[model samples]
Target: MKKIFTLIATALMTVGANAQDAKFQIYTEVEPNTYAVTTNLDAVKAEFGEEKVTEAWGMGVWLPVDYVLIDNANLKATTAVDLTPIYFSGNKFTDMQKEFPAYTGYMNLGSSLGQNNWKGTEVIEDLTALKAAYHGAVSVFPKVDGTLSFGVYAGDNSRSIGIFNMATEDEMNEEIFMGAWANYYNFRHDGVEAAPDGTIPAKGSAAYVSAEVKAGRQYILVGGANKNLTMHQIKFVPAQGTGINNAGVSSEKTIEAVYTLGGIRTNGIGKGVNIVKYSDGTTVKIVK
Candidate 1:
């Protein structure tokens, strides 16, 4: 009786350990491009060396002229795999550059109208161009099954953005509803006016949100609208092992048998490290 009780307790503990999830945060690694925090051009030029600031900006902008390219050499979230850059027609080639750390919302650069002069009719500038500076997208491909959580810079007003898990790149052609910080209808910039939406975060804070993601699927964070939204600190937390094979093959193969790490046959997955045998004769270790 005593031995049986001890075994049951051990099994419970093992299951708890196996159920633990791990979170990995991805950051923009390129020099002078910290995502979560905002910085000025002077600081960027100082840190990124003396290679003419405008020239550097031109190179960075021109490289991703057709599609979004994010450097992921320091990625530790899951099995590191090359992610394809996603392109959007809204992204236009112009002198306007998408500065890192801060996105000052889409503005009417051509109109010379300032945010402070929104009410004053000083020739209301065209603050309505759907420029890619505020409409860029980031793509993430995870080898492990997990959910995604990310933070976007939020100001006194609500900014619009979207998160989508797509099976193919072609699906990106469709539209996605704003997933976080939907637009605030009121004119409230610089904390002069109260945020119309109660859910809007305090001034200069990050609004964090979560989304479900599957293994081997392409997930994109799209700048859905011209609301001055900025993305940062994209993270993926593994939930459970999906049936993806070690060779990067995603399969829904039926389970034929299960066993413990020590090769002890088990009726079903219990705890600790589980050796799962698939109907196709492939075996994989799943923790859970």
Candidate 2:
């Protein structure tokens, strides 16, 4: 009896260890101008408070552009990848030149509106033309149900997280800072909310009511004080109970059936929000 019990215990321990090891295996991808990284879905949700994560699909994780591209070079290929310079106000260009000195890069979509003004009214100076600054600058994330998001900045900066979508326009913000001098964005899923008054609700305000995040427009943020933040890394966390293969492979049948939350069947997977039904009658949610 004792020997049998020992064998069973050892089996259980090995299984537990294997599960833990699976989370550390981060997956990465690189397209023409975009790169991505993903880790264990469940692990990310656990960190973001599974309850606060909306009920859609995908996740967004932001790190400084420098960290992701130049400094730390978290992604192996980014160090060698050429970042086409997009001149912003001539200052960003001069600064880059001064910093790199001997650098001669390609001309891509450079913004004259300094990196610090990505969230400022200047971004919409020409209301008709919304020129998105894409100097490897990641802006405007999609808000879906069950998605997790976090922000990263340089020099340990802290500022308000202004939530903007088309429906509400740019009139609302979440003062996501605890106190002055705080560095990281305090992800507040409860209590703190956005209102039409163009201000964030105070902490512990029970009367605060905010709209649910919807599709058709972007859900982006504007920092309280521009910390000179540039988009870094973005994470796509799989929704809970979705049998998403962390290894990034699924059955052929699973890829065939794609549906939106509105029950409309799409010919194939489209960008943005998508809920997928699997062959085993199990449904999973995803975003592109």
Candidate 3:
């Protein structure tokens, strides 16, 4: 029995040795870009430069003089090659007096579609240096295989939001009905609000919407219609809770028993390495 157990453990170890531990990383820190509400002109000028500030004044108060670059310190952690300064394309204008999408705000912070209607506000993290068109929606390079979550706020008029990916920028165009979409409740205002009990409420404010994502791939998020929706935050995290195991085995199995390294049976997974036996006659080691 001892030799059999040793053989089982060794075989399992050999199979699990190549299993990559699950982890998650975001290209940029998830926070509200507050340039929309900034009131100090000098501070804005200091960060955005005097020339851009002057241009905004001449064009409009809410217009973007140029694309806003969002810096990412953890780019190399997820991406083998550093792709920093993700570009938030500014609102375009045909003439100095008229903005393409009326009431469109600057690109760095939050923006509104206004009458521009669903022209697809872009958030490009260009990995191929293609300098793709600015209307391809929310383009990002995910660092690991996980699910992308968007914390967003939308008024009553908000429409469906779609999530998908493309191999290269060449696949982007004005009309491409790619990926799946879901319409969620109108969670308006800044973010999820706290209830009277001080616990965070999940509805009627910014809420998390998830989509499937692959590691080292480019994904896009775009609104389905030209309506009132504002993205407050976005992030990615490892997917879990699926009915699968590290060895790619699929069985309707449940934990039958658990034992400590010292051969003592435990009620549940304790605070260290444990040997877990499943109903399917498979045993594996877990560390807490």
Q: What's the distance in Å from true for residue 216, model 2?
A: 5.0
Candidate 1 regions exceeding 4 Å error are 1-52, 55-131, 169-198, 241-288
Clash pairs (backbone) in predicted model 2: 54-145, 54-146, 55-145, 55-146, 56-145, 56-146, 86-110, 88-111, 88-112, 89-112
Write down the RMSD of all candidates, one decimal each.
Answer: 18.8, 21.9, 18.6
Better of 2 and 3 by lDDT: 3
Error of 2 at 209 (Å): 20
TM-score against native, each model: 0.38, 0.28, 0.37
Cα lDDT of model 3 by residue, 53-160, tens digit? 565543222322222112121111211111111222222212211311221222211222222223233332232222122222345455445666554334322334
1 against 2, candidate with superior lDDT = 1
TM-score of 1: 0.38
For TM-score, the strongest prediction is 1
**How would you encode candidate 2's per-residue C-alpha lDDT over 94-168 as one tens digit per residue?**
433343222222112222333331332332212112223333322333333223232322222222333333222
Candidate 3: give the clashing pairs: 118-226
The models' CA-based lDDT, in order, is: 0.35, 0.29, 0.35
Clashes of each: 1, 10, 1
> Candidate 1 — which pairs collide?
105-228
Model 2 segments more than 4 A misplaced = 1-144, 168-217, 221-226, 241-247, 253-288
